[model samples]
Target: MNILQLNFEAGWRGGERQTMLSMLQFREEGHTVHLLCRAGSQIGERARAAGFVVHERKGSGGVIGFLALSGKRYDILHVQTGHMLTWAVLTKLLHRTLVVYSRRVAFRLKGALTRFKYRKTDLVVAISEACANSVQALGIQHVPIIADAVLPVSPNATRSQMLAGQLGIGQRKVVATTSALAADKDPLMLVDAIAALKKRRNDFVFVHFGAGALEPEVRARVAALQLQDTFLFAGYQQNVEALFGLFDVFVMSSREEGLGSSVLDAFSARVPVASTSAGGLKELLADDRGLMSAPGDAGGLARNIGQLLDAPDWLGAMTSKAAEYFERTHRLDTMADAYLVMFEQLLNERRRPRTAAIATAPAATPGIAVESHNQA
Candidate 1:
């Protein structure tokens, strides 16, 4: 399969990481994969370093220009981010290739253009059922759900210890969170939860990974609460998954999430998770796989953190269950294979003759008046 992945994210995040994982898996399986990303973007540089055919464009306008001028063709053009859907739609017009859009967020389609662009997609694959329901709300049927792949973790105890010492988390339990410090992620709430948890115990330190728009507000709140020692900020690291072994518990305080990919990483590392019930997080943490709290409930989150720390036996059993669940359902190969199957099914549909497809269509009842339409 010839695949062209379009991801224009300026920074690396869950969606960008998934895109890279999918590209690497497709390449490993002997498929020809190409990447189209923004110029100077982290994903573009990373893709180029990974030895893929990288096309770096300036912006959305640059993407349109490239689609108009490059004259390249592929078996599939997959839009990995929502913002780049317009460009992908235009690319479909220029190349007439099978267009697939990966919907990774659980945001409802709110605008005319957004709905139109989704309608134009040959296939829309959602990362979770929450995201699929969001797309299906647009009245588009058959939205398939393909969960995000669990990022592979290779733990080095030496590296983990070194990182713990570097972060000043020596000998103390580590409560880690790897998410953007944005409003939707609710980092301020995490600060409050850490403060509340500090009141209960002082043996654990909360280290939050990744940075975003709400950094100043989050810092201000942390300082006001005097959690300088209890709360630590570790800015985004490229191989964050490698250090998951140091985490005693992974916590998320997201107000909304499509799927908490970090929670999956925590599962892979066999670390207990304590996350709020936000969107697809409920799905991942179901069946006592992890501790859960209501969204924005700082008190509840604090209590869950305390439980995860206090009960060692239960914690071990829960982590073991979580690891088994992740291994059974969320491997990188599973996601890549599902995508290949979808790609082949779409290609077959394209290959079927128009007249033959029409002839096979179900006939309307004899007494009913059938509506006729012609549109693409």
Candidate 2:
């Protein structure tokens, strides 16, 4: 099968990492997977580096150039961003191919006009139950939950790990979070939490990865909290998968998340996590696999961080349980099989020609649609 995956991310994050993992897994299974990425984009380059074919097209909203590659033959065009919905719908009209829209964030329905513009995706794959609820609340009734994946369970990039050690204070205790510094991610809350902890245990290191519009404000908050020395801003490093294993505790304080990919990465890295009860955070730490805080509460977040920092005995058990859950439920191969099943199901369901898509010749693939459609 030939698959085309589209990701409209400029900076790397959990979503982008998941997209790459999915595409690469499909390719390793003997399918030709192509990536449609922004021209001059870092992801496009990384895709090529990973040995996947990338078709560079115009990416910014003003130009919307990925349209040119939409007509190319593909078994599935999987889109992971809601902002790209309009373009995905537009591409559907021209290509007449299956468009699977993967919803990752929880947002209210836009006004009628915007809603109508993006509802044409053939299928909507939500990453978590919370996200599915948000979609259904928006009047979309056909959402499916596929969960999320953790790329690079253990840090293999030796060079990347060495670089992380060299970054900022060498060998100080590191408590890190990975995010794009976006408003919904609530980076400031993490900063505040770490700062408060600094008063008691200033020796611990606090680091955050990724960059976004909130850069200045995040920095300002660090200064405001007087944690400039303790909190280190490690902007968008490609080697996070390698560096994550070095952290003592991984944390995320997002106000909203479609599915927390970075959090999954943290789990895969086997570092215990401290997160909030935000959109998809609970999915990762359900029933005491990890600690959770109330959304947008810095003090509450601080307390959670302090609990893990203060209680060294329980950290090992927490990570052990998390690693067990990840291996059993979130394996990459299982995720790939799930997606293949979904694509094959969409392909096989037309056996009786019940819908217009089946009025023509009904292609048959035995035993293909019986598997799960979850590419973590």
Candidate 3:
């Protein structure tokens, strides 16, 4: 299928990682996948590197820019949420394009305008069950909870062997979190959590892998908490997935997450995970395979970290389970196959004929409102 994916984020964060990997997978399967992103963005660079067509999304309003881009008789319009919904509605009205909303965030959206935009969409694809629920709560029908998948790649060198000299980490007991230094990510919480761990143990060091706006505050927080000796801000590294080998456990301190793409990286490397029950964490770790702390509670986060550090065997088991869970339920083929089915379904309801037989239009099967999106 000739698919067009529109994303608003320019930087290569977790969400961008998911999008890139998915597009690459489609290309590997011989599908024509084009990515619409900001000009000269990290996403554009990465997409081009992976051999996918990367176009710039221009204009003050993304809705206008996206609608103009939608005119080339594509098979499906895979879009992310926000003001772009206006474009999706217009595309559905004018070009009869199928709208697949990928709900990457789990927070409930307010206002009637937002609700109406969702109604105009044909299907909603969420990264996790938690996010799917948020779509349904807004009265959006035909919501499907599709867990995020990582396109399989051969294991690369571990970060420990790559940076063994500078990090002061032995390459065995490193606990890492790959998130942007945004205020909402709470990188300092992970620092403080590790600091609290030092009172009882000294076997591990913490690394926050992504760079963002809160770097100075995070450094100050580490100094204030006297955790300067242990915490490392690894900055933004494209080979972040490779770093999973350096860490024994993956740590998350997100105030909110649609679903953590980094956690999947850790799992792929067979690393255990400890996270707050924020956003999709509760749903992702529901089988008790991972530890979950209360959101925004540094003390609770600290306790969760300590649990994984002390019980190496238990943590190992959890890591294996996480890897197993991902391999079984979140394969890239499964994600792509589901999308293929949705596109085929949408094309059947298409009224206006396009130049391409593959062109699919927005049309939802009646009374098919999905409710399990709230499952976590």
Candidate 3, clashing residue pairs?
133-373
Put down candidate 1 lDDT per residue, 25-99, tens digits, no spaces: 998988889998899999999898899999988877888877656524677888898767788786666767678
Off by over 4 Å in 3: 61-66, 69-72, 81-83, 152-155, 170-172, 351-376
Best-matching candidate per TM-score: 1
lDDT of each: 0.87, 0.76, 0.74
Judged by lDDT against the true structure, how good is candidate 2? 0.76
How well is each residue in 80-127 modelled by candidate 3, as lDDT tens digits? 646455566665666566777788888778887788888888887888
- Of 1 and 3, the candidate ahead on TM-score is 1
The residue pairs in collision within model 2 are: 104-258, 105-258, 149-376, 335-374, 335-375, 338-372, 338-373, 338-374
Q: How much is the lDDT of residue 70 in candidate 2?
A: 49
Off by over 4 Å in 1: 354-376
Q: Quick one: RMSD of model 2?
A: 5.6
Question: Which window of 10 residues has the lowest lDDT sum in candidate 1?
Answer: 367-376
